[model samples]
Target: VKSGAGYLPVDPSYPADRVEFMLADAAPVAAISWSGRELVLPAGLPVVDIDAVDVSEFDGSVVSDADRVAPLRSSNVAYVIYTSGSTGRPKGVQVPHTTVAKLFANTESVYGFDESDVWTMFHSYAFDFSVWELWGPLLYGGTLVVVDYVTSRSPEQFLELLAAERVTVLNQTPSAFYQLAEADRLASESGRAAELSLRWVVFGGEALELRRLSDWYGRRGDFAPTLVNMYGITETTVHVSHRVLDAALVADASASVVGQAISGLQVFVLDTRLAPVPVGVAGEMYVSGVQLARGYLGQAGLTSTRFVANPFNAGEVLYRTGDVASWNSAGDLEYLGRADDQVKIRGFRIEIGEIESAVLADVSVAQTAV
Candidate 1:
């Protein structure tokens, strides 16, 4: 990321057909993967196997003036993350360097990320959550511990690994964190609870279940590693708002509180006509800020439909989040649910219509409903 070269991360667990589709969508200059792994990449696309060549063979090399790399600008594309499209294809969201940078701007002051911290890269590289997990530590001069897929799936083992690695900052989806919290509870009951070094627990990728955190708080109390829940989207570049949870906040289950907007972004709960709704009234969410993505790649119509011009600010655009939310009496945005059929289960946004359409494509099936 520091080299200013845009990269498209492909999930290793994705099927060959999905991988092929992503490769076609991104149209990357070259593909890189581990040596000996047979990947179904686009035909004629150059493949760079990182393990196939020895880096020591090309030491002390410098590019000449003619071959010098161009200076990177903030507007340059940083990466492309593909999200499942309602049209039965995945659409790539082109995020610029400025957008990603805005996420970390002044975050250190608020979150206290420093060189002494040790963070874990817990999410899949293809997932937008990994954008923060992978770079947050690196940008802050902290060590990033990588968790393997197998270990990550097993909550008990993952907890043991976190303790062994002395991870200070942990980022997890609410669903995944619940599993870890359960594992910790079991360990505590068995009189074998490991002493962890975690100082911060940041939750994202899904709506946090405040009730599910009772077990964790019962064991660790309210202060040890501060728990924070953030609500975000891929098009908004990651997180827009974050709520720092405490014993009082978690116990008060009045609403799906997702906290207030972070720096560099604005969140609006608007009516169907795109006008701001009164406080305490449910409305669709519209986000406008520096962190907004450029737009969906090769999807001008979809982009236009979702990202509309901001009437308040000339030449500025706002992304229609399609999430039903409202400003509660407490002055925090409370998430109600999706405005449409988009379901967020276990951190994955799934369109029910898309699945139904896929099932209907089979010749044997006359009709189907999701």
Candidate 2:
């Protein structure tokens, strides 16, 4: 994605037919794949087998500025990420360079990111969470530790990797972090818990259960690896608001407060009529500012429905997040349940309707429900 090309990432686990559908929708210029992976590329799209070429064989020649492809502008499409569709087919979201660039523009002050940090690419490339993991480090001259699919699946192996690599910054879904915290508990009991160098633990992609970290914090304490919970959506880049969690806040039984908006973004809890709801009253969230995506790819109707013109700003637009939230007494936004049936499991957003549709596709199935 850092190159001047806009690419679509496909999960290797996807069925061939599903892959074909995505390829047909995006109509990318070319496809790149690992040499050994069995992939069915679109009929005419060129395939670049990464492992087939040897870089040492080439004379290290640099392209002249005149001959090089022009650098992409901030408005250019950076990537297209597909979201689970309420309809039968998934819809892709076209994210521009400026939207992504804004995610990290002034985040260093809050997160304290620097070249000294060692980050891990823990999530799948197909997931938007991986965008921050992959680029945040490289863009700032920090080392990015890549974990294989197998290691990522096993919490024990993942913890081992984190200790071995001395990863300083860690990002995880609350579900995955729960497993890792359990593994840490087991390791601690056996007197084998590896000493870790993690300085920041950023959680996102799902609603966080603060109590889930009680055991992990019991071992590591509240100082090292400052814990942060971020509330975000793919449509609004990676994150919108961040809450720095401590033991005192975690012990509180009230709703999870997802702290104030990040730099260059505005968040509002509005009623059905787009009017701001009173504090402590639940309402649909509408996010504004530069972080918003251009809109859903090839989904004009859905885009128009969700991305409405900003009433406060003449030329700007706001993204209607189906999530319901309200302002707490502390001025932080507290998460309520989804306004719709969209559910997040293991950090992947799943539309229950989509699951029902897939189940009904079976030949023998007369009817199905999720």
lDDT of 1 by residue, 136-229 (tens): 8888899999999899999999999989999999999999998999999999999999789999999987888798887789889988889988
On the 0 to 100 scale, the lDDT of residue 219 in model 1 is 87
Tell me, by lDDT, which candidate is best.
2
- Worst ten in a row by lDDT for model 1: 59-68
Evaluated at residue 207, the lDDT of candidate 1 is 83
- Positional deviation of residue 138's Cα in model 2 after best superposition, in angstroms: 0.7
lDDT of 2 at 250: 84
- Off-target runs (Cα >4 Å) in candidate 2 are 54-65, 68-71, 363-367
TM-score versus the correct structure, for each prediction: 0.95, 0.95
**Which parts of model 1 have CA positions greater than 4 angstroms off?**
57-69
lDDT of each: 0.87, 0.88
